[model samples]
Target: EMALASDIGVMVTTDPSQAYAEPLHAWLFGEDQGRYLIAVPEGGVDPILRAAAGTGVPVRRIGTTGGAVITVNGQGAVSVAELKALHENWLPVYMA
Candidate 1:
């Protein structure tokens, strides 16, 4: 629920069934219509990526981004310097 509410939804779950539900719902309802799915190590292997990708949802392995750079459609890759800037600037505001 919290994930869906955020500007970016980051879901981490071991249960394949539970993992599939959110993305599937988003896919079906057009909730995250053009949103990109940035998957971490575990989430990188999620079936939802494939499903969402098939439906034109962009998905990418961006764990290395450290949840910094915001991407859409996974087409262009954000540079580490850009991510570092985001982290340095935003982390203090959000984390505090």
Candidate 2:
């Protein structure tokens, strides 16, 4: 819904750091009331960082969000779901 609800189109970025890695991935594939994209401008996170400093809040600006879904303008790239699914598969084993 992030895309459909937003007044304007959104863009998202990918961060290599563990802090934002998984979260970004989840956001990418989300649909029907989930985050789609965000255009985080350069130095946009500076203010938030300053506020969180010394408060034990760690923060890093990875990418300035902008552009189409495939072009999020992120720094650290995450493989797409199709490619990821091809690389691995899991099944649970139960013991009685």
Candidate 3:
């Protein structure tokens, strides 16, 4: 939810399930080494992509940023307010 805290939302257009050739769950939750999600500003991603390509690093444009809700491929969207409430209340609720 860092993007939400940064006053922006993420629209993940690419299906994360297609990230690997098999066992989608493994790719989704497994701690695959050296993989990273980098956020680049508009019009600035080209340089990053080019640099990664030069170094033989795999880079893909998965999403963009905006709005008040974080959604993936127009599916489930959880509002920032909901996420903040859950984060802020987790400790208190658990203590109770």
Report the number of clashing residue pairs per model.
Answer: 0, 4, 0
Best by lDDT: 3
Q: What is the lDDT of residue 63 in candidate 3?
A: 82
For candidate 3, list the clashing residue pairs, or say none.
none
Better candidate number, 1 or 3, judged by TM-score: 3
Better of 1 and 2 by lDDT: 1
* Clash count, predicted structure 1: 0
Ranking by TM-score: 3, 2, 1
Candidate 2: give the clashing pairs: 1-33, 11-38, 39-65, 40-65
lDDT score, candidate 2, position 94? 30
lDDT of 1 by residue, 15-36 (tens): 3333454563454335454554
Candidate 1 error regions (>4 Å): 1-44, 64-96
Q: Please list the C-alpha lDDT of all candidates, in the order they appear.
A: 0.46, 0.44, 0.76
| lDDT per residue (tens digit) for residues 3-34 in model 2 | 33332333354554445444655655756353
lDDT measured at residue 35 in model 2 versus the true structure, 0 to 100: 35
List CA RMSD, all candidates: 12.3, 10.7, 2.7
